[model samples]
Target: MSVHETIEQALVAPSYLAGGGDPGWVTVPLHRACDWSYGHDPLMPRVILTSPDQQATLRIDPDPDEPWWTVRHARCGDRPAWSATFDARTPVEIIAALTDALTAPTPPAPGLEPYDLLRQAGWHTVGEGLISPGRIAAIEHYGGEDGPWFADARLDQDEGGLIWRAYLSNTTPPHLIAAFAQALADPTPVRRPVGRVPAPAREHTLTRTVHLPVGDVAFALEQRVAALSARRKDATSNTHPPRSPRVPPPRRTR
Candidate 1:
C-alpha cells in the first residue's frame, strides 16, 4: 500500500477502548486530540480519544515514513503528561496499549519539584521562596471579591511533602484552601456523560481513493496548516487560567 493509504487506514481504525457513555470512553475530534500545535506537523498523522472526565486524552500520531505510531497521554492542555512510541503492532494492539496507558493512574505532574505547582497554577514565584507579586495580586483580588473568606490566606508548605502547598491563614476557612487545592489538583473534573449519546463516530475518514504523491499528502498538509491557524487564533483570542493536576492537599496544621 502507498504511504498515504497505510496512514489513512490506520487513522480510520477504532483505536480507543469501548466503554459506557460517561465515566467511560469516547472519541474526541482530531483538533481536540492534542494541541493543535501537534496536528500542524506535516508528517504526523494524528488521532485522539478522551475519557469523559476530560482528565485524560490519548493521542495517536502515526509517522508517515516509519512503521510506528507515537502515542501521547495528555491532560487538558497541549503538553502530553506522558508519551510512548509503538512499532510492529496491529491497529488492535495499538489501541489496547493506548487504553492501558490512559486507564492507568496518572503519575504526579511532570517536573513538580523543579517547576513549582503553584507557579504553574498561575501563582508567580519570587526569590527566596517568596510568592510572586502576581500571585499576591491574585490572592488580594480574589480575597476582596470573596470577602472574609480569603482574609487570612497565605501559602504554606504541605507538612512533609514538597509537591504541594496549602493556602492557609488563621482566620481563613479550611474549606477555602481545600477547595482551591482540589481545584488546582484536579482541574479537569470527571465530565458526566452528555445527552442522547450518538454512537461514537470517526471525526475524519478517507472517503474516496486518495493517491499518495498528489492528493493525500497535499490534503494532509492543508489540514496541518488549518489546524495551526486555528490554534494561533485561539492563542490570540482566548485568555485562559493556567491549569494544574490535583496535587495532594497541603498538610492541615491549623
Candidate 2:
C-alpha cells in the first residue's frame, strides 16, 4: 500500500498498544534529552540508542512476530545489573514516563520510595507481589545483598499470563524509578479502543467509556521532534563555524 493510504488507515483506529503508533514517542525524546548515541537499521527499521557512558542501552523493535523482545533496556552497574523488556504491544506512553523521569538533572526526589509510592497509589501486598486496585496488574519486588531493589510491573493478567510489563532497573537512577511510580500510579485511562486491545485486557481493564482527547500525546511527540531538531541544528552550527585555527596544548615534559 502507498504511504498516504497507510496513514489514512491508521487514523481510523489510532489506539494505544494497537500497533499503529510510532515508537519515536519514546526513542526520540530520550535520545535528545540524554544525548545518547543513536543507530538505526533503515531496512529493518530498528532503533538502538546507547548512553554516553555505555552503561545503558535502549532498543525499540516493533516487529509483532518478535513479541518476546520488543522494547528492552539494560544497565551494567557495580554490585548488581538488570535488564527490562516489554512485549511489542506495550504502550509507548508508559515507556516514555520512565524515560522522561530519567531526564531530570536533580537527584531522586526527597522521601521517594518505590514500594511506598506503589502502596500510596492503591496497590497492596499479596505475598511477594503488589496487586493493583483493578487486580489486573501486579508488581514483583526484590532486594538484598545479592541484588538491588526493583519494582516490576506485570499488567493485564488473566488466564493468558502477563499481558504486558515494564521493568525499571534499580540502577536506573532513583528519580526515574519514582517517575515510573507516578506513571503507573496515574489513574488516567489509556485511550484504547475496546476491539483493538487484547481480549484478556478488556476483561479486567474495561471501564466507563471516557472519550478523551489524544491530541496532547500527538502534540508532545511533535514537540520532541522539534526540540531534537533544534538542538542538533545548534550543535552542527557550533561544531562547523566559519573557521578557527586548531591549536594543541603545549606538550608536557617531565
Candidate 3:
C-alpha cells in the first residue's frame, strides 16, 4: 500500500496498548498531536505526535536534501531531546517509535521559583512577588465571558516570606493542579540556571490564487448570474401577495 494509505490505516486502527490493561494508552487524533499540513509535499512528508501531558512530542520529517527520515523526540519544547534517522522504506519502525512515545512517562516539571512559577502560569512578574500590567489584563480577560473560572492569582508578602494564593479552575485536572499547588508551597528556591526568554512562536499564512482558463471563467460567471437571478425572483415573490383567481370563470359556469 501507499504511504498515505498506510498512515491513514494506522490512525484509524485500534489503540496499541503498551502493556495489558494500561489505562494511559489512549488514541490521539493526528491533527491534535502533530503539525501535519494537508498541503505538505509528498516527497518530504512530516508527522508529529505529542504525549497526553503535553510534555513530550515526536516528530518525523525528512530534510529535503537528506535521504533518511529524521525522527526526533522532544520534552518541554526542547527540540531533538532524542533523535534518529531511518531510510524511507522503514516507515513501520518510525510508527513504532511514535507509539512508544505515546506511552512513555513525561519527564518531571522543571523546578521553578515562586516568582517564576507565576510567569509560567501565564502571568507576568514585574518585580519580586509583583504583577505586571500585562498580567492584570490577562486576569481580567480570563474572568470575562468565555474564560476559565480560575482567572487570576493573589500574591502578597506577609510575615511569611512569600504568599501565593490561587484557586484551581474546574477545568484543570486534579493531579496536575495538585502538582502545581505543591510546587508553589515548597520553600526550596530554584537551583537551576535561568534560561533566556524563548523567541515568539512563528506564524504561517498560506495564500493560494487559482488561475482558470477562459472557458471555465465564463462558465463560472454564467453560474453566478443564474444564482443571482433566482435569488431576486424569490425576493420579489416574497415581497408581494399572490394574485386572486378571476371571477369570470365563476360567471361562465353560472
Go through the candidates in order and give each one's C-alpha lDDT.
0.33, 0.56, 0.32
Q: Tens-digit lDDT track for model 1 on 1-254?
A: 45444222122211111111221121222333333222245555555544545544445544544423333445445642544333222223223323432432332233343124445654553433324332321222233323321111122333221211122233332332333332332222121122211132223211222223434543543554455446545655555545678899889885
Better of 2 and 3 by TM-score: 2
lDDT of 3 by residue, 58-120 (tens): 455545444233333353443324433333322231233333333323424545543344455
**What lDDT, from 0 to 1, does candidate 1 have?**
0.33
Best model per TM-score: 2
- Which scores greater on lDDT, model 1 or model 3? 1
Candidate number with the higher lDDT (2 or 3): 2
TM-score of each: 0.20, 0.63, 0.21
User: Clashes in model 2: which pairs?
Assistant: none
**Candidate 1 vs 2: which has more TM-score:** 2
Looking at model 1, residue 166 earns an lDDT score of 21
Better of 1 and 2 by lDDT: 2
Worst 10 residues of 1 by lDDT: 15-24
Q: Which stretches in model 2 have alpha-carbon errors above 4 Å?
A: 1-22, 62-82, 143-159, 168-170, 192-195, 206-218, 224-254
Candidate 3 stretches with Cα past 4 Å from truth are 1-45, 52-54, 62-64, 75-80, 91-94, 101-254
